[model samples]
Target chain A: MKSMLRTETQSKRRWRYVYAIIPSRKEHDFGQIGLDDENVYTIHYREIAAVVSDSSTKTFEVLDYGITHQQALEKIMKEYCVIPMSFGQSTTEGDIKTFLSRNYPKLRIYFTKLVGKTELGLKVTWKIDTTIKEIASSNIKIRAMKHQIEGKPLEKTYRQRLTLGTKVAEELTKREEKIASEIFARLGRISADAKMNKNLSDEMVLNAAFLVDKTKEQDFDTLVNTLEQEYGEKLLMKYVVAPPYNFVNVRIRS
Target chain B: MALIVDDLLRLPVDLGMKVLQAIADDADAMTLKTERAVREQVLKTQMQFERGDLPEEEYRATMSQLRKRLDEVKGV
Candidate 1:
C-alpha cells in the first residue's frame, strides 16, 4: 500500500509555473508571492533564468490568477529586463532547462532589445455629447442641417434629423482619428516603439502603448502632462507605467 | 452464419474508420476554435473592466461566468 501510494503521488507530479524570463546567471528566490503563496524562485540555465513557482494545477483560471502573474512580473521588472510569458505556462524543470538551452540565442536577443525599456499606456476619452456639440458648431454643413431640423415636428423632420445625425457621427469619427494620429505622432517620436490598441468605447479617442527607454520616461511624462494641460477638460487622459505586455510574449511548448 | 460473417467482413471497414477519424479531427479543431474565441472574450472583458466601462461587481460576476464556461470547454 505504501509503495502504491508513492507511485500514485509520483504520477501526479508538480511542475514549475513560469511567469517571466530574465537575463541572470545566478539563481535567486523571490519568496511567497506566487499563486497560492508558493515560493517563487528562479530556475537557471546558462545566462538566462525563468522566475517560477511550483504548481500541481495544469490549467489556471486567467481571471483569478492573471493579476498575480502580472504582479509577479512587475515585481521582477524593477531589477531585471523581464520577457513575460503568457499566463498558465507550466512544465517540468528538465523541460524548462532544455527549452532555455535550445532558445538561448533568441532569448538573449530579446533581452538585449528590451533592456532598460518599459511600456507606458495612455488612453484618451471625450464626452460624446460635448464632442458632438463641438463638431456641430464647427462644421457648416452639420450646423446648417441642425438649424434646418430644429423646432420641427418629429414626423416631418425624421429624414432630415437622420441625415444630421449621420453627418455628426462621421465628423466625430474624423475628429477622433485626426486627434489620435496627432497624439500618436508626437509620442511615437520619443518612444522606441508604439502600438495602438483598439478603443473600448465610442467615447474613447485613443488607446495606445509606448515602449520608452528608461532615460526617456521623464520626457514622455512631461509630454503627456503638457498634452493634458493643452486639452484641459475637453479630453480625459489616463496614463500609467505598465509591464511590456504588448511587446514581448514568450511561449514555450513542452 | 458463415455467409453472414463473410458479408460483414466484406463491408468497407477502411472507409468507416476514415470517417470516424475525420469526425475526431473535426471535434479537436472545434475545441481549439472555441478555446481561442473564449480566450479573446476573456481578454476583452479584462480590458472593459480596466477601462471602467463595467463596475467591479459586474466585472467580477461576468468574469465568474466566463471562467465557468472556460472550465467546461476545457473539461476541467
Candidate 2:
C-alpha cells in the first residue's frame, strides 16, 4: 500500500510549470524546490531551453506563488543568463516548445542583449517634511509669500494662503523633475540601459531599473552608496542588486 | 437590491411593478455615478498625500478602501 501510494504521488507530479528560458547546452533538472518545491528541470530545443518544474497544483496562493517564481528565476540566473517570464507564468513542456518556436527571433534577441547583463533597481524617496522646509527656506518667491503672511491670522490671509499653496505645488513638481533627472544622469553613465517606472507612491521620487554589465556591478553599487551618503538626510535610497531583468524583457506576445 | 427590498414590500402590486421598472432604469446610472465618485475621491486623497497633507499609512489605507470600492462597482 505504501509503495503504491508513493508511485501515485510520483505520477501526480507530471505537469511542468515554466519559469524562464536560457541558452540551451544540455537538458538539466534543477530538482524539487520550484513553485511548491516540485522537481525542477529543463526542456531544451536547438539553442535555447525553458526552465520548468512539476506543477502539481491547479491553484496556488498568488503571493506565495510569486515568491517561489522569483526564487526559481534567481536560481537559474546564478549559473546562466536567463530572460524571465512575468510572475506566475506556467505551461506544459509542449506549449513551452511552441512558444519558443514562435518567438525564436525575439528570444534570440533577448539572449544576445542580456548575455552577461543583469538588472538592478533603485528607488529614491524624498523626506517630505525636510524637503518642504528646504524649499520654503531657499525658494525666494515662497520665502517672500511666507514673509507676507508672517503674522496674519488664517481667516484674513486666506487668499494669500491659496496663492502660496498653488505656487508651492508648482515649484515642488519642478524640483522633483529636476532631482529625478539629475540622479538619472549621474547613474545612467555606468548602466547599459535604464528604464524609469512611474512612482508607485507619493513619497517616491524615482523608481528606476538599470541593465548593467556583470563585471561593473560593484562600481554601480559603490556609486549608489556614495549617492545615498550625499543625500542621506534629504532622501531614502533603496538599491536592489542583480534582480531578474523582467522589467525590460518580459513582454513577448508570441 | 436594497432599493427593491426597502420599497417593494410597502407598495401595492401595481405600484411595486412601476417602482421596480424605475429602479431598473436608474441602476446603471447609479453605478456609474458611484464609480465616478470613488475615482474622484481616490484622486483627491492621492493629491493630499502627495502634497504632504496626509500621512503614508492613512493614505495607503484610504487608497486600499477606495480600490476595493472601485472593484466592487466594476463587479470584478
Candidate 3:
C-alpha cells in the first residue's frame, strides 16, 4: 500500500517550466509572475536552483510565451547570475532536481564565467541601392559589364550576365567581410566573448552578440556610438542592451 | 500556305516547354527538401516534449507553421 501510494503521488505531480538556472543555496518564490502568470518559484538542488513556474503542459508557445520567459530571466538576472534556458524548457520538479545534480559542475563553471556579465547585440545594415552603386563605381569590370548588358536581351547575353552577377556577389562578400571583421575585432576587445550571427536579410551586414562585463557596458555603448558616427549613412547601426545572449552563453545539453 | 522552315518547326515552342518542365522539377526538389527540414524539426520538437523541455501547444503551433511554409514552397 505504501509503494502503491508513492507511485500514485508521483504520477499526479505537475510539471514546472524552467526559465533560467541560478547558483543559489536557498530556495526562492518569485510568485505568480511567470508564463500564464502561474506561481513562479525555484527547485533547488546542491548549490544551484532552477527558476521555474507551474506548467500545465509540456511545451510552450515560442513567440508569445517567449516574452514571458525573457521577462522572468531578466527579473532573476537583476538579483542573481542566471544561466538562461531556452523558451520551452519545461520539466517536472523531480527531473529539474536530477538535472541540477547531474550538471552541478558545469553549472558552477557557467555561473563563475557569467558573474557580473550580460549580453548585448549589435546589428548593422547598409542601404541596398547605395551599396550596389558604390560597388559598381569602384569595380571597373563590373561597371563596364553593366554598360554592356544595358538594354540587351537576357537570352542573348545570359552567360555574360551570370558571370557579372557572380563577380558582383564575390566583391560584395569581400567588402562585407572586411567591414564585419573590423567590427568584430573592435568589439571583441572590450567583451569577454562574442558570437557572430547570420544576417536576417540581404541588407544586414553584421549581427553579433557580445558577452560583456557589467562594468564595461558603458564602454561598449560609447564604442557603438562612436562607430555609428564614423560610419554615418553607409551603415545603420542598432544596439540592443540588457538582453540574455543565450547564443553565446548557454551551453546546450550541458 | 507557305511556311518557313524555322516557323514550321517552331523550335522556341519546344524549348519553352522544356524550360517549363525543368522549372517544375526544380520546384518539386525544393518542396521535397523543405519537407525533410520540417520532418527533422518535428522530431527535435518531440524530443523536447519527452524531456518536458517544450509544451504541447507550442509544438502544435510550430508544426503548423512549418507545414504552412512547406505549402508556400510547394506553391499550394
Question: Which candidate would rank higher by DockQ, 1 or 2?
Answer: 1
Pairs clashing in candidate 1? none
Query: What docking tier does model 2 reach?
Result: incorrect
Lowest lDDT 10-mer window, candidate 3 chain A? Answer: A245-254
lDDT of 1 by residue, A11-95 (tens): 5756888888999988888989898788899999888999999877767777887667766767887888888776678888888
lDDT of model 1, residue A44: 92
Compose the digit string of candidate 2's lDDT tens values, residues A80-133.
888776554555557777887888888888778788887877788987656666
Q: What is the model-wide C-alpha lDDT for candidate 1?
A: 0.76
The DockQ figures for the candidates are 0.04, 0.02, 0.05
Expressed as tens digits, the lDDT of each residue in A1-254 for candidate 3 is 99999777656547778878887888888878899888778888887888888755777755346556666767877788777776677777877888888878887887787878877777888755456557766888977876776666758866666676667667867888898889989998999988887775556789887889999999998998888887765788886654454432443233
lDDT leader: 1
Candidate 1 off by > 4 Å: A1-12, B1-40, B43-61, B65-76
Q: Which rank order by lDDT, best down to worst?
A: 1, 3, 2
Q: Specify the poorest-scoring 10-residue window by lDDT in model 1 chain B.
A: B5-14
lDDT of each: 0.76, 0.69, 0.70
Q: After TM-score superposition, what is the CA distance of residue A122 in candidate 3 from its true location, in Å? A: 2.2
Model 1 Cα displacement at A167 (Å)? Answer: 0.6
